[model samples]
Target chain A: MELVKRLLSGDMRAAARLITHIENELPDAREAIRLIYPHTGKAHVIGVTGSPGSGKSTLVDSMITEFRKKDKTVGVICVDPSSPFTGGAILGDRIRMGNHFTDKDVFIRSLATRGALGGLSKATKDAIRILDALGKDVIIVETVGTGQDEVDIVKAAHTVLVLSVPGFGDEIQIMKAGILEIADILVVNKADRDGADKLALELTLMVDLGHEEKADQKWKPLVLKTVATKNIGTPELIETIERHLQYLKSSNLLEINHKKNIEREIIELVNEHLINHLLGIMKEGDFEKLIEKIVEREIDPYSATDEILKKLYSN
Target chain B: MSYERKIRILVAKPGLDGHDRGALVLCHAFRDAGMEVIYTGILQTPEQIVETALQEDVDVVALSLLNGAHMTLFPRVRQLLIERNAEDTIVCGGGIIPEHHKPELIRQGITGLYGPGTLLDVIINHVVERVKKERWKIA
Candidate 1:
């Protein structure tokens, strides 16, 4: 509670502590979130995801610089995929954004997905809320940029920026449906490379073609190009983000998206809570017994789940 | 009670050291040990490392110094942690450190001074045990 008060007053250390608690899934984390939940819903949550080698980290680094130049306080959560073999992650994205490491106005934390296939949305959303409650003007969530399932970032943020680079081989195949569906702003990063223009054109054409149903919609997914390391086209990227935010506000899409995000958060929390609670009440080896039964084909998963649920709800 | 919390370690390459192969290896190694490793990448200052440890509330600060700045960077981190009242966070280092410098580094509160060819298990065991002992004491 003391930490929550400090976090509410914009204390960076408190914000960090709250994030650590959430990441560890500690007992007090829920209490802290409960106290700080009221102060959230103000920060603009942006999700940046793409494939490896897409320069996503450098692009996010540039975006942070752009946001800082405009005097905005930014909190960035760089989510790295946990190694399945080790449950550890090398969250090296901070190397690209270390330019802002010493800046008081900028707070960056790297989170490991912790082997969560759904990209650890539960902990990530809590970290974002803590940052939002701490009064960060813009909160950017950067993912490892893997594949379709990475779309979890979309449900967690208001604006999702999907990045891709040229010479990635078959640019058309790279701009698949999953990314185009979730992307509010599509970026062809590493734009100074060859086929930059061609890739941008392909993406623009794809965006225009895929979302034909929303022709009357004022906000179309804009495909911008950037060379992040050289800082080329970053200002334009910043402008595009601003334009999207403006459109979201004007169209009242912000409220709608916020509502959807809350619904998703509620479902995630409930799922996690129920699983943990069940595990707590179950006797030792009970779960393994159920797994064994399922493995031996003695009981189907649906029936086994129903049996467990009945036990859970019974006295 | 058995240790339950995740041991978050900040693997930092401080100073002008751009060669991060060792640091990168340690990141995955520690992670495989079921610890959360936050790689700060190369070219971090001592100040940045300490601040990251404070903010992240890491159980350990693992410094990989291939650029021979270990003497300064390691101790500076320890001192800063002390000043910040975060001495409970363990400070450790490795990479190209000469045997003679190990004593002084450990004397300054930097433990587990792993040098070249140190086994990954050696480092992991030291960290896992140290964190459990340290944290259990606090608990």
Candidate 2:
């Protein structure tokens, strides 16, 4: 509670401590989230995701500068890959965005996926909430796209920018329905390279064709090209992000998205709690015994689960 | 019950040093050792390093300076951390620091003024042991 109070009072130390608590899955993390939940919903959550070598980090760095030019306080949650061998991660977001290290308005933190399939830690949402409560005007969550984790991570954003470099192989794979459904803006980074125009054109045609199937779609995703390292087209990218934000507000989609996000979070929390509680009630020996029985052919897993469920409800 | 927290280290390159290969290698080393390493890339002012160490609440602040500014830069960070009442954070450095300056640097609160040829295992052990002693101290 003191941490929450200090966080609400704009203490960066307290905010960092609370984030550590969340990351470590400490006991009072739930209390901190409950206290800070009401103070959120103000920050514009933008997710930038792309394949490795797509210059997403550089793009994010450029976007941070553009956001600051508009006098907005920005918080960045950069998700980095964790070592599968050691269960550790190197958070290198600061390396790319080091110029803003001295800027008080820009607070950047790196998160390890920690083996989370969504390219984000489970505590990422709480971390975002803490920044939002601290009154950040824009919170950018950046992730490296590999699979479903990227898609899941982008769900936290109001505007999702999917970046791709030329020659990433198979434009059709890039324009899959799952990817297209999540992208509010498509970017072909490294536009100075060869095949940049071909890549952008392919993406544009895909977006246009995708829209024809969903006739009721009001917002059209704009495919843009950028050389993120050179800071080219960043202003236009920011403008497009702002436009999307405005569209969300004017159409009242912002409130709808907020509600949907909270709903998803609650369901996840419920599932987590239910499983934790059930496991807590069942002794380790009993669970292992069930496994041993299945191995010995005395009982199938289905019946073992049924028996456990019956015990769970009976007492 | 005291909860065990991850050892977070801010591996920073202060001053005009542009060679980040060593700093990045150490970042990977610390991370592989299971400590969270926040690398403050290159060309960082002392003020920026201290600020990041404070905000990140890191257990250690390791400076990697190859630009011959260790005496001026390392002490500046230690002083800032002291002024901010974060004296508990272990301050250390590596990267071409001369032997004669090691004593003064340590006297000024830098624990590990490692130079070239210091093994990653040694640095990792030093960090883990130093953090254990300081973190569990009954203040």
Candidate 3:
């Protein structure tokens, strides 16, 4: 609780230490998070995601600059993938955001996906909460390089920016519907390339096609082009991000989003506690034996679940 | 409580060093070794590197430079770490240093000094051993 107080007082090291504790999932992290709960939901959380080599980090770097120029304090969580073999990671997104290293107001932390099939680390949501409590005006969560299906960011972010670049593949790859469906904005970064216009145009048509069916949808996703390295079009991109946030505010969507985020966190916490408690009572390898029994056809999977649930509820 | 912790390292190049092959190579080696490496690309100032080490809460700061400014840059990074209350963060260097500078560099509280052709595994082992020995942070 003392650490949580320090975190609320904007102690950077306290925030960092709490994040690591959450990342490692220490028992105390839960308690500390409870203390942090009342202070949550202040900052605007933006999620930036894209495939590898699509300039996600570079674009984030530019956005940080734009946000800083507005005198808004920013916190960045950059998630990179951990090796499945070694469980090690090179959180190299900091390399692009290096210019902000000495800026006191901008706190950038890198996270490893740690084998979480989604683009974000398990720690990301809590980390965002900590920064939001730390009084950051804008908090950015940059996902690990994602494929088309990594849309979990939609749950964690108020606005999601899905980036694309040319040379990734053909037009069909661009027209595909998974991540594109979740985008509040589609950014074609590295837009100086040969096929930049084609990519943006294709994405625009794809976005427009999706809009035709849901004409009542409040916010039409914008298609923006940016050369992040050269700082071209970044100002407009960030303005669009802010615009989306304002739209969320003026409409009732911000309240709706806050309600959804609250519901998601509670459900996730309940599920985590249920598993931890159930596993705590079971003998080691007991679950494996149950699996073996199912595989051997001695018991059905539903019965195994019922048995576990009985144990969970009997006490 | 027994989760395997990831050792975070910041591989940085400071003082106008354009040649970053050594730093980049070490990033891959560190990643493969299961450490979380934050590579701050070339031309980083000591202040920037130290700031990163503090923010990322990295266990090690690995500096690789080819600009013949190691003596100034390495000592300065160490000093900045001390100034920032991060004396526990290890400082390591790999560049074009000569034998005569080794003692002075060590005296300045820099460790794990290496030059070209030194096996990355040796550095890896050094990091693993050192980090493991002091691994009670936030436990």
Candidate 4:
């Protein structure tokens, strides 16, 4: 409880401890978060989604450096895929950004998706709230690009930067509509490569064609080129993000998007909570007779559903 | 007499290192030896790691660091465990840990320093023997 209080007061150590508790899925951790949930939602959530080896981690490291230069506190949640057999994640992304470990202003967490779809962990949304409550100025959620599921999950961010690198075979194949529609900014990283210009041009053409289809929208997606490893063009990329944030605020889309995110979070929370509760009840043998009746064909699945709903509602 | 419960262990990777094949394989070996193993996903800070070990109430905290941040990360983790009153939790480490660094790691109060090529059974036996001795002393 004292630690939870400390976490609420923006203590980095306490915040890190709380994140570990959540990652380990400790039952008491949930209660701790429930106590701190009211203090969250102030930080800007940025999602960086891209294919593996597209320099996403390097880009994140560079962006954090830029944010620090401006004296902004940043929190990064890097998601890695888990090994199904061992239920452990091979989190190697931090190797690229190890230099920032000593920065008290920066908090980096590596998460395993735990086989969750959408490239986000089941606890990721909760972890973001924890970081936001700790008063991070910018919270970056870097997802391992695993196609459409990842792109869909990143839609929660205030801004999503879809990263791509030069010489990646068939850029068109990887740039499916699921990702194309969600990217707020398109970054062609590794700009020093020979094909970088060609990739950027192709991306620009795609964005232009995309805007033509949505004529009513005023803001067009901006394409930027960068070499993430060398920290080249990263400052401009951060500026582009800031500009996008301002635009969203002035255009009043910020509130609209924030509301949608809140609605989604609440729906998901309640849905999961109710399912767990129902499962507990069922495990208590509350559904045995109903299951038996169904097995005997005394009730159809539709009737069984109605029966279960009635029992659940009566409680 | 109450049966002695199997010792639980939390094997974690702290910091931005992505090499975890060692950690995963070790978890399996521990499980096969009838131990309850909780593997914290990668890139954990020292605090996240200590907290998980406390919550799990593990008998040992075994960490695998291959990213060369072991010098900085391991000591902090050892200190945190001490602060958390988990000093009795045997802290061990393995992974491309250089032979030259083993003495320093042991000097920092790490119980054991395992390196690549160490047998799984050797680590497990050492942990079980040490934990049993500790429990016996407590009793």
Candidate 5:
């Protein structure tokens, strides 16, 4: 309880502890968040995503370092795949940014997907809000690059960086359309590797082709090359991001997008809270009976749904 | 009813590196061992992880890290657990944890480290034993 109070008051330890409590999905964690939910919504959210092995982590580490150089506080949320069998997060991704653990200015967290179909967790948005409320100047969300679901989650960010690397071959094809559309900036990471230029050219052509399709869309996503491992070209990448941010601000898209994000978040929170509450009230035997009826074809899912809705509405 | 309660484990990938085959496999192995596992979907801050541990009221917090950021993330989570009086929760880790970092991890309060090729059964057995010990202590 004191930790919750401290978290609301902007205590870093309490914030960190609260985040862990939420990730673990502890009951008290929900109460703590409910208590502190009113104080969130100030940090700039940046989503970085790319194909597997595209150096997204390295790029994010570089960005955090750059943000720190400016004396800005940052939070990084690294999303890793959950074990499909056990429904637990296998948090192997944190090894890339090992150097910043002690840097008071940086707070990094990892989440395992827990069988969330889209490679994004339900708790992600709330976790972001917690970090935002904790007063992080910039909050970076790094998602696993596993097709459409991941791309959709990253689009929630003010700036989305879609990363690609050489030698990925056909996986690039899978990423081309879904992730490409949302990318504010395209990064050709691992630039030291051969084919980096070729990939960049291919990406540029793809973006051009997409623009041609969109016709009057004025915003053309910028493509940049970087060797994230060595931290080369990170400064230019950051500058491009800043320029894009300025563009969004000038065009007034920032406020519009922010408002939309808030609206979507509130809807989702209410929906989640309502569903959880209803489920809690349902008796286990009642759910089992419904399942049996469905299995026995005694009731169609549509009818069953109506019945369940009636029951939920009544209570 | 002689039903065995499934050991609930929370496996978390901390930091930004995203390779997760090892974590996935471990989750499968744990499930096969009859454990109820709650995966904290990816990019969880240390706070999210601790929160999940408490909320789920899980038996263990098993983390897998290939990216070298374990040094900071692990200790911070460990410290946070202590602060929350949840230090009784067993914290074990695995994945490409470098040989040199073992001493530091153990010293910093990680209960155990499982490297590549360590059998899931072995890890499960160890966890069962550890959890039993913890329960005995509490009892």
Candidate 6:
């Protein structure tokens, strides 16, 4: 509770320590977050995701600086994958964003995927809330160079910027329904590359096509080009992001979207808590026996699952 | 929802060291050992490194400097850690450090002075032990 009070008072040390607690799921962390929950939903949550090597981190670094120029405090959560075998990870995104290391207004934290397949840490949304409660005007969630199925960010962010680079792939890459479709803004970063113009053109066409399909859609997603490393077009990109935030505000979809996101989070938490509780009650030795039986075809997985659920829920 | 603690470590290179082969190799080594390692790349100042350590809340700050500023930069990072009230965040350094330099660095509360040809297992084991000890203090 003291940490929550300190965090609300904008103590960065308390903020950082609470994030570690959230990531590790310490006991007092739940209480701290519960106390901090009422003051959330102010900061604009932006999720930046794209394929690996599409300059996501570089773009985020530039975005942080741009937001600072506009006098906005920023919080960045950069996720890298954990090793499947060792459960450890090399979170090196700070390598590119080192410029803001000494900036007190900028808070950066790196998280390992921690076996989460969604290109994000399980604790991301909660950590975003902490930053929001700390009074950061902008919170950016940069996913581990994501693929098609890593669309979980759509539920966590108010605006999502999906970056694509030249030479990444053909039209099929963008045409996919998962990552690209979730974009509130599409950025052709590394636009100084050879195929930059063509990629931007294709994306523009795709945006137009989507608008034609949905005539009642008020906000049309924009396709912008930026060479994030050199900072070219970065200001325009930030302007677009700010414009999107304004749209969310004027339309009053910001709170509406926040509620929807929290609704989904509650469901996910229930499912996770139920499974964890079930795992706690189920004897591991018997669970291994069930697994052995299923692998040997002595019992089907569905039946085993049903039997376990039936046995546990009978109470 | 994990009860087991994960070791969060920062592998930073301070001063003008463009070469990061050793730092990166240790990154992979730590990953293999199941620790979360934050690498800020090369040319980082002691202040930047300390800020990173503070924000990331890392259990350890492992400095990898091949630019021969370890004597200055390493101790500088240590002092900043103390100044920032992060003395609980242990400090360690490795890279072309002279054998005679070990005691001075240790006296500054910077340990794990591993030089070249030191086995990866030894370094990993040292960090794991140190972090466990640090956690015991907290718990």
User: Which one is best on TM-score?
Assistant: 6
lDDT of 1 by residue, B5-29 (tens): 6778999988998899988888878
DockQ of each: 0.59, 0.60, 0.77, 0.14, 0.12, 0.90
lDDT of 5 by residue, A24-121 (tens): 57678778777777777667788898777778888898888888888889988878775565444445455577557656667777665655655566
Which runs of model 5 end up more than 4 angstroms from their true locations? Answer: A8-10, A170-176, A212-216, A277-284, A313-315, B1-139
Query: What tens-digit string does per-residue lDDT give for candidate 1 at A73-94?
Result: 9999988777777566666777
- Which window of 10 residues has the lowest lDDT sum in candidate 1 chain B? B1-10
Which parts of model 6 are misplaced by more than 4 Å? Answer: none
Docking quality of model 6: it rates as high
Top candidate by DockQ = 6
- Give every collision pair in model 4: A91-B18, A92-B18, A94-B16
Alpha carbon deviation, residue A226, candidate 6 (Å): 0.2
RMSD of each: 2.5, 2.3, 2.2, 6.5, 7.6, 1.6
Model 1 bad stretches (over 4 Å)? A171-175, A277-286, B1-4, B66-68, B98-100, B136-139
Which candidate, 1 or 6, has the higher lDDT? Answer: 6
TM-score of chain A of each: 0.94, 0.95, 0.95, 0.88, 0.88, 0.97
A187 Cα displacement, candidate 3 (Å): 1.2
Give stretches of model 4 more than 4 Å off.
A169-175, A283-315, B1-90, B94-108, B124-139
Docking class of 2: medium
**Model 4 per-residue lDDT tens digits across residues A1-315:** 887898888777677667766766777788988898889878888988888888888899999999999999999888877656655445556557655766778888766666677877776888888889899999998986656555645546899898878777765664566775788898999899998888888888888987899998877888999999889999999999999899888999999988887788788879878877776666467578888888999989899888677767878
Model 6 agreement with the true structure over A26-132: per-residue lDDT tens digits: 89989998899899978889999999999999999999989999999999999999888999988888888988999999999998888888879888888998999
On residues A260-299, what C-alpha lDDT tens digit does candidate 2 reach at each position? 8879988997887877777678877988899999999999
- B-chain TM-score for every candidate: 0.92, 0.93, 0.93, 0.91, 0.89, 0.94
Give stretches of model 3 more than 4 Å off.
A294-300, B135-139
